[model samples]
Target: MKILVCISKVPDTTAKIAFKDNNTSYDTNGVQFIINPYDEWYALVRALEIKESQGGSVTVINVGGAENDPTIRKALAIGADDAVRVNTLASDALNTAQNIADYAKKEGFDMVFCGKETIDYNGSQVGGMIAALMDMPYISYASKMNIVESKATIERDIQGGKEVLEVEVPFVLSAAKGMAEARIPNMRGIMAARTKPLNVIEPSNTDYMTEIVGYELPPAKGECRFVDAENPEELIELLRNEAKII
Candidate 1:
């Protein structure tokens, strides 16, 4: 079995987000990037576990520039057998999915894994896009997954209950929490990662339809205006006028 795990590089949670170039772009200056937690903690680790159990290979793929190499290497250290870096800086979800789908097609991977969503963008579109591009089955927001006799059993969280579905090989799954545990690369793993093959490939020619035009932080919170708890009319008026809910 050949499992391909798609990893994304995102801003660290602690990094303050800002924009530049007339607010049309993210301010990358002095920004810290990390492996997207969902990808690293659930998707990649689950792929690794599958490989260990089933005797297969796990390869990590990333669509980004040179700066993404560190997080890619960290995934390698956490047990990905190898990695492919598509040399591009395109952050649009559709373009990134295209890049990964193009590579997956050429590689003939049996299974593909990605995070439920990136923390920064939260688009949650790439996995389905990749599956559609590859003409394969797509299962999203999976909290648990198992493969048996070339069929995949996936469990995903829904509004009030979990949904379980089964699909055959050559499918895509976007992993969420409860899929697997996060791993920290130990000294040995880190040293071994240095020797692991890190293949950099030029991205396939594809047009990006989406672009970041501008960004802004949400407005700050206002002071709370407490009302008498026993007054139902006041609450109704507050909801109808101040909160605008009713």
Candidate 2:
């Protein structure tokens, strides 16, 4: 089995987000970036587990410039056999998916894995777009998957329940939580990652379909108001008038 895991670099969850350039772009200065949690904790780990059990290779791919190499190295330390960095700015989900799909088509990977969404953008569209570009089946929000002799059994989350599916090889999956346990890179893996291959390729000529105009933070939260427990009528009045929920 040849598995391709798509990874992304995102601002650390606790990083203070800010906009720059007249609020048209993110202020990346002094920001610490890491592999997206969903990509690292579930998608990449699940692909590694599949490779370990099935005796195949797991390759990690990222769509970004050289600055993302550190994040790519972390994926390698987590057990990807090799890495591929598409030399381009991840302008939008569609272009990123196109770059990945272009490479995956040439490589002819049996399975592809990606997080359901990126933390920064929260656009759950790349995996499906890749699947469409590759003309393969796509399973989204996959929580569990098992492969046996060219067939794959998958369990995915739905509204208030889950669905079980079966598909042949050569498919794409957007992994969600419960796919696999997170793995921390040990000293040995870190050292081994230093020697792992990190290949860089220029992206094919593709134009971004969308552009960011501006960004604004949400309004500040209002201060809390206290209501006396003995004043039930007052509380009801407050709910009806101030809180407005009735």
C-alpha RMSD of each candidate structure in angstroms: 2.5, 1.5
Please give the clash total of every predicted structure, in order: 0, 0
TM-score winner: 2
**Candidate 2 lDDT over residue span 4-27, tens digit each:** 999999999999999998999999
Q: What lDDT does candidate 2 reach at residue 16?
A: 96
lDDT string, candidate 1, 1-246, tens digits: 799999999999899888888888888799888889999999999999999998899999999888888889999899999999999975677888899999999989999999999999989999999999999998889999999879888999878899998889999989999999998999999999999999999988568888776798888888888888787689889899988999
- Backbone clashes counted, model 1: 0
Taking all chains together, each candidate's TM-score versus the true structure is: 0.90, 0.95
Cα error, candidate 1, residue 132 (Å): 0.6
- TM-score, cand. 2 vs. native: 0.95
Show where candidate 2 strays beyond 4 Å: 228-237
Deviation in Å, model 1, residue 209 alpha carbon: 1.2
Residue 147, model 1, lDDT: 92
